[model samples]
Target: MPTKSLTHPVRTRASRGDIAVLYTVHLDTSHPTTGCDVSPAAVHEEYVVTRVTSVAADGAVTSVQDTRWSYDNSSRSLQDIPGVAKIFVIPQDRVDVEAALATAGAHTYPDTTVLRPYATMDEVCDAINPHRH
Candidate 1:
């Protein structure tokens, strides 16, 4: 008997209208901490970034085809993978995040860090609105 059974299937595209918050962490452990000269010992530490998604106020449909101009353009899967189940995104609270990072000596770089921002809704509308005249 097979230990695994057919369960879920992969779809090429997401639903017509769906909002998602992608998460990623940067891992760096090259900090050095072997000095005793300083009063508190300025040791190196690692940082884990926790960024939130750009709020789509206009309810724009996000898709892989045109995400090249959005903050969530990365095709990297934040879900549906091995060991991913263990990871969880904290609540949407910057203060909490900062406090947590302060305790852990970490930080988050949402837009400017892991992902890049592309064409905004204003730009898209400006480009199309002017031409209709």
Candidate 2:
């Protein structure tokens, strides 16, 4: 029997008057095990974006973009855990990009202390590495 494990909800919304951009992250894990357990684990992460047509009407959805990342670790090693950094090129006007990103920063995972924006995955990794200095 497989066990249902970790679930994380991440949501972000940015709006200027009637138009809005929303971003969300969903993580699901199955067959997870602790260090003492001798089983493997599977994890999936979903990233979604929804463009709002109107804020007054409870933010009707005008467009959406969804992407996913997944990994399997049978070694039961903590270092095998997958990294979850994604770059989304939203097709909105240039004026809206900053506001949208600001909203994303405000609604990131509570445990995250720093929310620096990066242009590439390598930059993100470098910023988070403790030994980078």
Q: Which candidate achieves the best lDDT against the true structure?
A: 2
Q: How good is model 1 by TM-score?
A: 0.20
Model 1 per-residue lDDT tens digits across residues 51-104: 333223443212221132334534333332212212222332212333332222
Per-residue accuracy of model 2 over 12-63 as CA lDDT, tens digit each: 3323222222222223345655666534233333333223322223422323
Provide the overall lDDT of each model, using Cα atoms, as 2-decimal numbers: 0.27, 0.30
User: Candidate 1: deviation at residue 53, Å?
Assistant: 3.7
The global Cα lDDT (0 to 1) of model 2 is 0.30
- Worst 10-residue stretch by lDDT in candidate 1? 3-12
Cα miss at 2, model 1 (Å)? 34
Off by over 4 Å in 1: 1-49, 54-82, 93-95, 106-133
Model 1 clashing residue pairs (backbone)? 69-118
The parts of candidate 2 lying over 4 Å away from their true place are 1-41, 48-89, 111-133
